[model samples]
Target: MSSATSLPIIFVEEGALAAANLSAAHRAWADANGFTGQRGRLLALPDPQGGLAGHLFGTGPVADRPPLVAAQAGAVIGPGQFHFQGASGDPTLAALGFRLGAYRFDRYRAGKPAPVLDLPAGADADEVDRLVSGAALARDLINTPANDLGPDALDQTIRSFAADRGMECRAIVGDDLLAAGFPMIHAVGRASAQAPRLLDLTWGNPDDPKVTLVGKGVTFDTGGLDIKPASGMLLMKKDMGGAANVLGLAHAIVSAKLRLRLRVLIPVVENAISGTSFRPSDVLTSRKGLTVEIGNTDAEGRLILADALALADEESPALLLDMATLTGAARVALGPELPPLYSTDDELARALMAAGTASDDPLWQMPLWSPYDAMMSSKVADVNNAGTGGFAGSVTAALFLRRFVDNAAAWVHLDIFGWAPEARLARSQGGTDQGIRAVYGVLKQRYPAA
Candidate 1:
């Protein structure tokens, strides 16, 4: 079995026999072994001592995979110092996936976690440092179960993160929630002993291009009055995935010091059942003074996020982004690997798509279709908590939140799985940072100076 170590890998390509000359040790070996060098294949090369010269992996024609491909490749490669020698054999993907694959939830134990992969040849030292640090930070946040990662825990994490970078950090907890005028956030999280909190961290000069990030931080969701079944609750630990992803994005932004002024808003809560828990059909007023009729208590992620997004939009940040594990329909539409994104700006959508493709964090654009607006219309209030039958659950959810951000210049809503369902080459099954790298790429490219 391969242990966590750096391993060198190379790519092999097929060429014309009589038309071209191929004389490298790799090509010679491939010819003899009948290895056509297809995509994502790995073959062991000779070390002469046979101890392991390196890895000869195929990535089809160009020998390139998305950065997300790093997960599976990292999983299969030997865990020691190794680098890629073939086409674009830079260690970016390997390092990205290696850090991601190394994630594990061992919070209860005293055991030390996996060590960081030392950079191999061809890996950009600075880039590897930034990505690995961010990936590790995201994994640490996700791997912690709800038991220890409740609202207050997330608050502390964000505080430390902000302080480390010399950014401003503030959190509104419990009764302070009422004082802060975030009544909805207070109502949703009041049931849990852990006080519900809204964490805000801002970096960069106020004059810079404004970028706002909002993440759903439901530390655990028990469906409130509309409780989920046992199987559904099994993975409730990952309910804070959106929050984890935001931290991932923040890490990248701060590490690279992207030119834009970045602001992060996370509403941390645990949708627990208690005598004080809000019930279905109960009316609650948000920070913006819009009364929301809770149609289904299980649809709580949006509730908490509403207050955060309103807070974010109040500034009319140049870019407003909120990410959440908001709907099952999104997963059904795009599966776990591809996240569904809702946006009004076509150019922004294009940029996000291109960034997703280039970074290997692919995103699919789903319309905030105006027609679906009627589906969420509530008789008594501005909007219903959920759709009547859940035909376009993702669309309806995005529409619901859309009401809160009318003030923002540009807005994006990501309904992401944030968890990998199974392990593929360079990816593993568990709490994953879905669509994170792509968003980072998009934001950094749009505003490159920091």
Candidate 2:
């Protein structure tokens, strides 16, 4: 695509290509040029002086697709300033998607530069920039291989990231976690050669509304002693996606200076196989002093989160949020795009859904069903890591996590898939972090800096 800044974009719907308000000459030119507005089609018109007249981008019905569909046009269109003609959707979302669509990893290989696009009229440039930066940083982190981003590396990454922004960062590694009383974290991570650690980051005024975010940082899941199938291990690198998302959301919050004391807790570990690997049927104590029996060591994400969540719950922050690539049942129920959200408060859930809808980062709310809570009961311990029944795996996981949370005014848990199985307009087919943007939206609404 040519990097010409003067090109204009004509938004055409599949059902209204011919009926759109186009001039006679341009309409005739479009018809002659065989532009039918089918999705992913682009048509360019030439002016009398042999310069570019304008561009035609085909899109689906306004209600059928997400606002980021404009990202497809952004990906292919000429590098230039583009002003939409006759588009009826939110211009701000379109611009945001356009900027997102221009992303490429290119860490190990060089790629073409992204074409520059001017912010659409009435769009908040600063907001778009923040989101794009946060999301891209998260995506890059998730996409990195586990070999390059182990528990130690992840800790250093968080420390460096927070240090650059002047946020206080600390971590308790190896045997230190045991002395710190984070037994579940130490138990789950003891098998890996790389030591397990808890990464803590804090920022903002102590007197402000307290908000805490906890993320599962299992760097790689070989499923511990209850190993996953060979196929299942392929994407285990993304198990720490929750940590990446929290970092991304943290970036957005701190950058925007939202009026809240923010704390990020991540229990970084590698669930590797070794002589000392935690076994299925082993009972481990947690920071909260709850005894959890390991029905399946593969279900380790929640075990680590149990200790971290207990720590976060101690303070009773105003709002507590935890995200994890926790359960496959979530993907079976809602598929890849819609992450499942579980909240303790209805008002908080409603607000989050509204924010997600408003920001085009929607999530589906699932019940924290108490009936399934019994499935996690253990004869030898207070609770079992794996459920007795195979059904409602996602719900059972949420219920187990809920057991660790108390005293917070509002708490929401998101079981995110954290990977895009296939490529989309703005998202490449790799480690794709979900639900953070919507969460950020809700946070901004509830606690915007004065």
Worst 10 residues of 1 by lDDT: 14-23
Model 2: per-residue Cα lDDT at residue 380? 94
lDDT of 1 by residue, 372-421 (tens): 87887788987888888669899999999998898788899999887767
Worst 10 residues of 2 by lDDT: 1-10
Q: What are the models' TM-scores? A: 0.89, 0.93
Q: Model 2, clash count?
A: 0
lDDT of 1: 0.78
C-alpha lDDT of all candidate models, in order: 0.78, 0.87
Q: RMSD to native for every prediction?
A: 3.8, 2.6
Best-performing candidate as measured by TM-score: 2
